[model samples]
Target: MYKVIFRIKGNQGNSFKELRQAGFIPIYFRKNGKDEYYVTLFRGKDLGEVKEAILDLSYYLSKNGKYGDFNFATIYEVGNSNLGKIAGGTLGALIGYYAGGIAGLILGTLGGIFLGELADIEMGEKLVGVLGWPMSISR
Candidate 1:
């Protein structure tokens, strides 16, 4: 399975949704000292299709006059501004996971590999504060 992790500087929530909707499953975790989000395309029968779909999105954001130059910074800023306030809450967490699931569906539509036997996608299982304090998160 190929993995691509992009630094999200925005809403850890909505961007989760957007990415999920794109079919790439969201797996949240931490490494070193940074919080990380991973989106993987492993179930695809066609790697080229997956790559193309993601590239298409990137291209749309890059050349779409109004949203042109949309890159990591833009994604981060938007996600932060919109989803930042939803850091902690039972319902918020559910919403985040749902977003991830929907993204998986979207990815399916875009011809990714998140299908049938490979539909296992979800958010990370942790609720540490920005300070990395351990918190309880019940499934």
Candidate 2:
């Protein structure tokens, strides 16, 4: 749950690639003005390494003369994406069983999967969008 929190300003598409290379599984990251985001990377318990990645990213950005302010670099232990998805799916299946019998179960599970996937922070910053979870950025 070593969740990396940061924001990108305007368009810097290559940052996503660098982030992936930093051992972070991209959950949801896209070009935007500025917004806090949680990536699927923070699996380990080492904040030093996480901070290094952030520093590396900052250095990289500085080299390219991109957005210069990499502030509020912090680490967080966020909820597991797989666990959250499974819970969502299971809850969906249960609700489906009550709503439309077997068909509902299938539909609900599928819907749940989609919702779960959307809920996936592994794909990049998607958690904030799907669940409205406030960006856990800290200094």
Instruction: Report the error of model 1 at residue 106, Å.
Output: 32
Once superposed on the true structure, which residue ranges of model 2 sit more than 4 Å away at CA? 10-14, 30-40, 70-72, 79-86, 95-139
- Candidate 2, residue 88: the lDDT equals 70
The global Cα lDDT (0 to 1) of model 2 is 0.57
Q: Per-residue CA lDDT of candidate 2, range 1-139, in tens?
A: 4655556443434466656656676665554454434444556665567656665665555454444333434455455457557867898899999999999999888888768865664444323211211233221
Candidate 1 residues 1-139, lDDT tens each? 3334443332223344445555665554343332334434323544464554455434333232211112321111001121222332333445545666765444433333222112322231122112111122111
> Which numbered prediction scores highest in lDDT against the true structure?
2
Q: Output the TM-score of candidate 1.
A: 0.31
Model 2: ten consecutive residues of lowest lDDT: 126-135
Residue 125 displacement in candidate 2 (angstroms): 15
Candidate 2, pairs of clashing residues: 2-42, 26-122, 27-121, 27-122, 27-123, 27-124, 28-123, 28-124, 28-125
Q: lDDT (0-100) at residue 107 of candidate 2?
A: 87
Model 2 lDDT at residue 27? 66
